[model samples]
Target: MSSRKAEPREYHGAAGGFGSLQGIARIELKERAGPGAAETLYRQNKPEGHMCTSCAWAKPPNPHLAEFCENGAKATLWDLTSERCTPEWISRHTVTELRERSGYELEMRGRLTEPMRYDAGTDRYVRASWDEAFAAIGAELHRLDPKSVTFYASGKAALEPSYLYAVFARAYGHNNLPDSSNMCHETTSVGLKKVVGSPVGTCTLQDLDHCDAIFYLGQNPGTNSPRLLRPLMQAAKRGCKIITFNPLREKGLLEFIDPQDPVAMLTQKPTKMSHMYMQVKPGGDIAALMGVIKRVLEIDDEAKEKGLARTLDDAFLAEHTHGFDALRHTVENTGWDAIEANSGIARADLERAGDVYAGAKNVIGIYGMGLTQHVHGSQAIGMLVNLLLLNGNIGRQGAGCTPIRGHSNVQGQRTVGITEKTKLAPVEKYRELLDLETPEEDGHTTVEFLEALLDGSNKGFIGLGGNLAQAVPDHERVHRAWGEMELTVHIATKLNKTHLMPGKSSWILPCLVRAEEDMQASGRQTVTMEDSFSHIYGSIGKRKPASEQLKSETAIVAGLAKATLAHRETRNPKLAWDEWTGDYARIRDLIAHTFPDEFHDMNGRMNQPGGFYRGNGAHDRIWKTDSGKAEFTDPTVLNACGIGEADGRFHLVTVRSNDQFNTTVYGHSDRLRGLEGTRMMVMINPDDMERHGLADGDLVTLIGDAEDDMERTVRGLKVTPYRLPDGCLAGYFPELNPLVPLWYHDKLSKTPASKGIPVRIVKE
Candidate 1:
């Protein structure tokens, strides 16, 4: 559907409840899957059904009758649609013609029905058998060094399939397993590992029950993880304080509605979630955190002098942590003037928030891209850990750090071994299982993979699932690099932009979505997924496949892998690929063989009440860090205003509309932001607009201003005056992703600094 003009309407209530009901109802009508659609929605995250493909929010033991959210409906309906893209449709349209549609429309057209291969002669995809596609791909793969190949995992992949991909890639002799996490939560992984020895979040969902305070630092759960609103509202109702530190006012964090609660729907009353919402400037979160910690140290000093209980958890700090004395001294010496200037938070507000944090018995810190997508992302995350450790907030019933992961299984995929920088699990374990030596060299990350593609170091890419070209920053450069690849294969269920821009020769291997029944040779199969909180469980699709030609991801990967590996000397028939493909339980057994501590007896453990928890050692007052204790890191953050000397540049933070999740745009309307039907505008503070002599809808061109005068610009954006911090602009991603420089990334995590782009707004 082409975007319509001006239907901007304000949603004057808590997010969710009726709004969610309306969203599901609307999507239900669009899909016309009938009563079964209702069953489909209800069965999601429940036993004998699928987990949500929308986000990685932790699931409760018992799912609500409506066990899904607004965005969840979009994700399910979009994947479970009745529409199909047949080879006939491909023949009718050329590659150039199909490339014109937005990613939303391409996906809305529905599931890909059959295997197809690109025909250079006709510029169209021609029907091909599974064997033909696999053989062609295998032939090309055999000729290249494994180092020239990259396997990118989408967030949608279930843990079983993800594990297979990882094992298969390494067994084939390469570790180039770049994934969606590399783009989103790589900083969290790098930062948390350095601080707590765990790459995942330290807290579990059960922590929310006893939580006293929740801080949102650059995180907006409203759009990213709507299911988190329920717990947030429950905490608020129980007198828990929710403090927010974001550049813009996010609706979900401000207020929430429990869609599952009948009283909430009838009363129409909203639960105000945030006790204090600070409009922290772009890239000011780390500084704001330091400001709060500085005040906390002061509060602790005063409390000790008054002969009262100290704010600092001295006992826990002395026992489980190191470097507290030095960190406390450094924070005490920090000037309030510098903190305010850098953090964009007043000293008084910081003190107020600090007092609340120090008073709370249990505190939980929540964050998302805003915290991780910065130049000093790892340092900021370390500060978050440091903030929690000051009061021993972690390793308790209701305290810890949370990174709101988007996509259903992005974190799960990471846990199961989709990594680039290093081996997730021991290589010796997999070497015996696969009967092959794993690659010793480090692999390519998303950015590094792209760099390799351009330099002719990498030639082939196998995308398990995801829109690599659309999702990455510097879109034009990424697309150009894709053209240089020798081969590009996308195993997907829909037609995305990445599929349109194929390599010299490309193949579209249509595969099964999670909601579709994957009947393998063994019998009906079930795939497992890990949530944001590291809860692992099984999910089985109930609906019939849209097309018989469609194959399960496991089957596709298995078939191609069998064909490709057969030609290599490393191939071993005794590895029993057929058995693993036939019954996914065999795959689980293989995984358990590797990670026995977590997945041992995988099939037996998943049938438990709420599945199994991948334990975090840091949550139990056990330190697995390199130093055997939690080490304090200095929280020194720079501010945009102070860093620039009267430069006309604005600090732009790329954001998603309420209708969008990751790169998937459900619709053009963003009701929460009062936008009716357009993605061609940027959100700016009215004060900033006034300073620039700009009006509400002024057309402007934006340029990325790096320190060395490097040029990166996105043009023709209509300004939408919003309630934002002064000198900060908000724009939608994938579109605004072009404005993010590929070189501007966190040095430690290698995640692009998408949230803190320095931009100069000029009237066009």
Candidate 2:
């Protein structure tokens, strides 16, 4: 309990003004990119340079000189650092010693200079040749059954590598391909697909320009996707109402100063971002959404009774949707008391939200991990889709659901067939392009794959990128399981905690990042990525590779595939691995050939300015579902709040600090939350702290409320009072991931319920 303490202060300044510039300057100085900072920042998110690896906010058709945000600069500078994690430097530290370092410290050690192999004899990583590493990995992979080997990818990879990875996995004869999507936006895919017949968001960047109202649910844009703040500010300036529903009044949603706007930056007068901020409690999004829908319906009925203009789009409902009557009945039959109790919002406020929603001609529903990382995440997403469906907001100029993605190419990975589901994989395309028949059996998701690792069903792991050991829930359990694997290979630009959890035969293959030049036999190659808006674009790194020994992800995957399949008997003989690695265009050609509809002219279109759209069927009102129309989920079957009956336990939501992105930590400070020098602090309501006999900086231990009888606990967390709803607590992830049992996830999507985790906070 004595190990935790934090410097907490109140931040009255708006998001993204001088604060962002200061943060950017700090990172640039720390990374020694000060001299080249202007050039690097200006080139980010531009057609001529590499894409920003931070977040997947769509690039505007006409981007500003400083198109990137503070986090984007952090990612770019972090990759552009002069430090190197050479084999000699790594040999000085033991695995146990390296494991004790923080994620930020480990990553800051610098980029991996070459391949490394774990030596159990010395308990340290030793230098290994690329060919030797690949051969050893391939031998182990060949020895194990395809089902026992899982191929995991991080969204940080570009499209060329992602496509090659999926093709190699399918060609290897199993579907155990789980990527970053499974952890972050899988629920968005699962929930939206059921209703609109498309697994991606329907809205584009252009939609923000014309929307009358933008409803933000469980989203903090300032930290998650700062580039989005510009559009939101523009919309607000044009009189568009921005309504936000979240547990905390995130500063980003309250106000913002556009760093790109010269006048706003000079004056320091913040632009009001949100017209209405609904501070809903954890696990209350579904109930709150239902409450709003009920009021909208009630108002529509009143208008009908008065023979006035109908509030609901009756024509769209009749011709374009199904199960409306059932949905209406369920909403009407539900009592106001249940809605008010579950949502923690009064009837009057719900009606007011409904009034704004009903008055808007076009409304866009924007959400993030808050809506997807819960016990009932899919249902929450479905409810949002249904709300937009009510007013015929979808398939319009400025409306539809948009799930802001955290990774730059997470969607692109999925689009190129990185999925565990047999139905979701591009099976026919693989058969056509690679002359291989993919396995039809459904494979493991991120959760299921980890379970496989724990149960001994899976013995091999091949990570294209990411720090899975820390990214998933039940961090300790997952890390222990990883150490028992037969072979574990990580393809990354730098060292991470995952590299320290060495298996029986472990290796690290350093690859070129998106911000570095990736030279191949075809010459300096450009890679592609798909944003949250389904815009596929190219990225050509301007800087030289961190090390000449490093290989591009495409080359690494191709090398491994060639070596592994050499040992196994396969029907496919024309894989052209050498040719594909030599020319990235061949990979893109295969991708275009496989998903013709989405990537038809990929090679030509990917490099074009602003890229080309991977058109969404739902956006065109062309439902591809069995019913051939948008389907409404039966509301009776959905839970209002899946966290369970109210008790003395506090609902803990694990969140990312402003200094971190996903599992990657950049620094110890969170400027937005006004917490510095530590990530071990918890934010709780003032009333809850008083009830628990706790004061600011008091240490506490949170106990999991899982029924599995697992003893999950995290101690030495400093409590800081905040404006969160009573009985709700917020803390950083990975640190608190231990309290989230591996089983605590959405049953349908299998995404970890990082939000709304029921736990007992006991002061130490």
Tens-place lDDT per residue, model 1, 65-178, is 777888887788878877788889877999989899889888888789999999988888889999899999988888878899999998888888888888778877788998
In the range 127-193, model 2's lDDT, one tens digit per residue, is 9999899899988898889999999998888888888898889888789999988887898888788
The number of clashing residue pairs in each candidate reads 0, 0
Superposing all C-alpha atoms, what RMSD in Å does each candidate have to the true structure? 3.0, 2.3
Q: Candidate 2 at 267: error in angstroms?
A: 1.2
TM-score of each: 0.97, 0.98
- Lowest summed lDDT window (length 10), candidate 1: 1-10
User: Which one wins on TM-score?
Assistant: 2
Candidate 1 residue pairs in clash (backbone atoms < 3 Å): none
Q: Which ten residues in a row have the lowest lDDT in candidate 2?
A: 1-10
Model 2 pairs in collision: none
**Model 2 global lDDT (CA atoms, 0 to 1):** 0.86
